[model samples]
Target: MDEDDVSVLVASLLRGDRRALARLITLVENRPRLRDRIMSLIYPYTGNAYVIGITGSPGSGKSTLVDKLTGELRTRGKTVGIIAIDPTSPFTGGAILGDRIRMLSKSTDEGVFIRSMSTRGSLGGLSRAAYDAIALLDAFGKDFVIVETVGTGQAEVDIVDAAYTSIVVVTPDMGDEIQAIKAGILEIADIFVVNKADLENVEATVMALQMMLDLSDKGDWRPPIIKTVATKGVGIKELLDAIERHRAYICETDRIEKMHYKRSKVRILEIVRSKLMDKLIRELENSGELDRIVKCVVEKKMDPYSAADEILRKLDKK
Candidate 1:
């Protein structure tokens, strides 16, 4: 699409056209030359949606929780958008798309928009286009935007950096799993959900989480641990209440503004990082410097650090 097409697309997206919004998201995900232009056009329309991030170890029932939470949000007459980041297949570079299948219940609802994105092998757990998709959903007038991460093993805390309120979901069955997860991931939680509450060891898991929270250095706001059987929808109301409580607390204390500033800074840094890496790779490939550096390193003619320095010097010349 040309600049004129982008203009019309932006206009339609702002006017709440789902088709237009989907097209814009595709453009942003592909990092088209006019991507910044699309974002600039819609940025002002954002900052309206309340973004919630849900992350946890795999098999924690996070997707089910998100589906329940979306239903709960809809009961309050709120429009919701869900971005479920699934692990990408290395060979195919495509996601299983299971989240979409699980959330087929919402497919017929006009007020609900569900999009499943591949992690694209990002260790951070979120798709690189996640924030861009969130912005598009917000600008399209979603009342609440939920981002669910791939949540393999280490539990990427990057979701915390992007979300206004981050929820960490943990299940009771994973033996010694809580202790195995990174401390940084634990500290990022604003609310914790011990899902599968009906399962054995639920109390043990809850107590462990409570002890952890008690030991945390959260100044005024202590993260709440809510027990949930997401599949059966038990404890969902209380979970939703806890989420709202945190949202209210942040707003009351004016912490939301601080979070907004922090998230904006992160977004800017990510964009700069991506652009710089892309430019450097393109230049190196064009100059044949990348192949030469790899060959030298493989042949032990030059150390990786020295070759990296050489590449930096070449970049500086450009």
Candidate 2:
């Protein structure tokens, strides 16, 4: 699309047009060339939405919990935007398990907007376009934006960078006690949720989490462990309450400002690194230098580090 077309969409989005918002998100995701213009247009309207991240291991009922949480948020007269990151399809490279299908109940709600994205070979449990999508939702005037990461256990810590309140969900059967001690996931949670509370060993799971929290130096705010049965819409309100308390704590202490500064630093550096790498790879491929380097490495003529340095040197010369 042209610059004028993008301007029109941004205008529509600012007027709370859901179709325009969807179109803009798709444009940002698929057409990276237009991302800078689109983001610049919408950046001024963002920072109004509160972002919440829900992350956990596979089969932790995270989707069900998010569904319930969105319902509750709507009841409280809040417009909610959900970004569910799903695994990438090997064949099409699209989202394999469509979260929008799972959240069909909210499909018709005007106040609730849902979008599913594929991890697309990106790590840390989120799609590469996730940050951009969040910005679009925030700019579209949602009161709350919820990001549910692909359930990949440890690597999901990246959610902390994107959310003001980060929730880590676990189940009674997941052997989470051991998982907590081993993974960095435990360190990032603002709230720990033991979903499937009706199952056996629920107390054990809670105790394990409690023990871990006691051992860690959480400073002034300690993570609360809440038991939930998300399939039955249980403990969802309490979870939301916990989230609100954390939100209040951060706001009162002015830690939110610190978080925003840190996230901005990380986001800018990541974008710069990604853009530089993409440009370098394109240049190497077009000039056949990448192939020549690979051939030399294969034949043991040059080491990999030397090959990399040669590529950088050539780029510097150009």
The best candidate in terms of lDDT: 2
Q: After superposition, how far is residue 224 of candidate 1 from its true place, in Å?
A: 0.8
Q: Give the Å error, residue 172, model 1.
A: 1.6
Winning model by TM-score: 2
Candidate 2 regions exceeding 4 Å error are 89-96, 121-125, 153-155, 176-182, 315-318
Report the lDDT tens digits of candidate 2 across residue range 1-318: 798999999999999999999999999888888888999999999999999998887668888889899999998999999988776568744434654456547878999999887677564445558889999999999999999875554337777888999998888888844554434766788999999999999998888888788888889999999999998999999999999999999999779889889989988888887889899999889989899999999999999999999988986887
Question: What is the lDDT of every predicted structure here?
Answer: 0.83, 0.85
TM-score of each: 0.93, 0.93
lDDT of 1: 0.83
Q: What is the C-alpha RMSD of each candidate to the true structure, in Å?
A: 2.1, 2.1
